[model samples]
Target: MWRQVALEAFPDAGIREPIGASALAEAELRLGRSLPTELKQLLLESNGVIGRTHVDTVWTVDQIVEQNLFFWSDESLARLYMSFDAFLFFGDNGGGDQFAFVQKPERADVFVWEHESDSRRWVANDLRDYLGRSLSAGGDDWYQ
Candidate 1:
């Protein structure tokens, strides 16, 4: 379903193979949080997709954890960089900005972590809504 939505919404997207359950589990273990169901379903259909306008790529599960740690631990970055304790980083905008699933106990929404402002803003209700918005967004206007 996610694959179909992706292809239908963005025909030029580069899709990769689905990842195994163990790999997903390992990522969750490393992050110490469970993956969102919508994201898991999307990954199970296709590990990641590339070639979006605003977002360069939807990172694979392993890359999600790695990128999260890289941002969380990089002291050289702006002091405004947020801790990974509160979000599950998942995708990148090719810029320093990141897309994540909000991990707060009451909210499991999707947000964009702006690199320049070091601020986060809710962008979608969940993974499905995010994919729909970003994929259908005609150009970089999605960012603004």
Candidate 2:
């Protein structure tokens, strides 16, 4: 379902191979939280989609781990973690901007973390809604 939405958004995009069950399990262990059902389903279907607008790449499980580690280790970037420690980044805009799932019990909403401002804003209610808006956003005016 998410793949179809992505393809509709960027017909030229390609879906990556599905991540192994062991790898997914390892990621959950590392994250210390169960991946959202929609997220896991999307990954199992396609590790990530390439060549989409707004979110240019849906990061693979390994990429997720590496990116999180890189940002969490940095002094400046790590500052945001103090306030929003529950965030789990999963994609990038290819312009240093990141998208993540805010692991709150009430709702794991999607948020965009702007690299320039070091700020995060709620973007969508969930994975499916995020995919729809991302694909539908024309040009670079993603917020519009």
Candidate 3:
């Protein structure tokens, strides 16, 4: 179903092998927060989803853990921008902008973290909406 949904949005969407339950547990443990339910299910369906222009429309578990940890802990980033603690980053725009879920409020909405200005803005209502919008838009700056 996940693959079908992705393919419907972008015919050439790339689907990867799903990660194991243990990997999901570790990702949540390391991130110190449970992933949004839809995201967890999607990750189990495919570890990642690659969209237009080879962009990481949905990143693998490892990348998700690493990126979130870096964003949450980097001191330089702390000093340069607003806190990242409220967000859980999972994918990139092929440039620098990233996609994230609001972990603090625990909502299903997906937002884009504009790297340059450190701005967070709503782009899609939920994970499925995000996949549809990002994958079908066929452009790096789809949210823009």
Candidate 1 regions exceeding 4 Å error are: 53-55
What is the clash count for each candidate, in the order shown?
0, 0, 0
TM-scores for all candidates?
A: 0.86, 0.82, 0.97
Candidate 1 per-residue lDDT, tens place, 1-144, comes to 978877777888778899888888898898767888888888888998775763555788878878777766777653555565677788766767778887766365888888777788888787777777777777633755
- Best candidate, TM-score: 3
Q: How many residue pairs of model 1 clash at the backbone?
A: 0
RMSD (Å) of each candidate, 1 decimal:
2.1, 2.5, 0.7
Q: Tell me which of candidates 1 and 2 scores higher on TM-score.
A: 1
Q: Which ten-residue region of model 3 has the weakest summed lDDT?
A: 31-40
Tens digit of lDDT per residue, candidate 2, span 13-128?
Answer: 67888888888899888866677778888888889766554344578888887777666567865555554456778887777778888776536688898867777888888887
In the predicted model 1, the residue pairs found to clash are none
Per-residue error for 93 in candidate 2, Å, reads: 1.0
Which 10 consecutive residues of model 1 have the lowest summed lDDT?
A: 76-85
Candidate 2 residue 64 Cα shift, in angstroms, is 0.7
TM-score of 1: 0.86
User: Can you write out model 3's per-residue Cα lDDT over 44-113, one digit (the tens) per residue?
Assistant: 9999999999999999999999999999999999999999899988899999999999988888999999
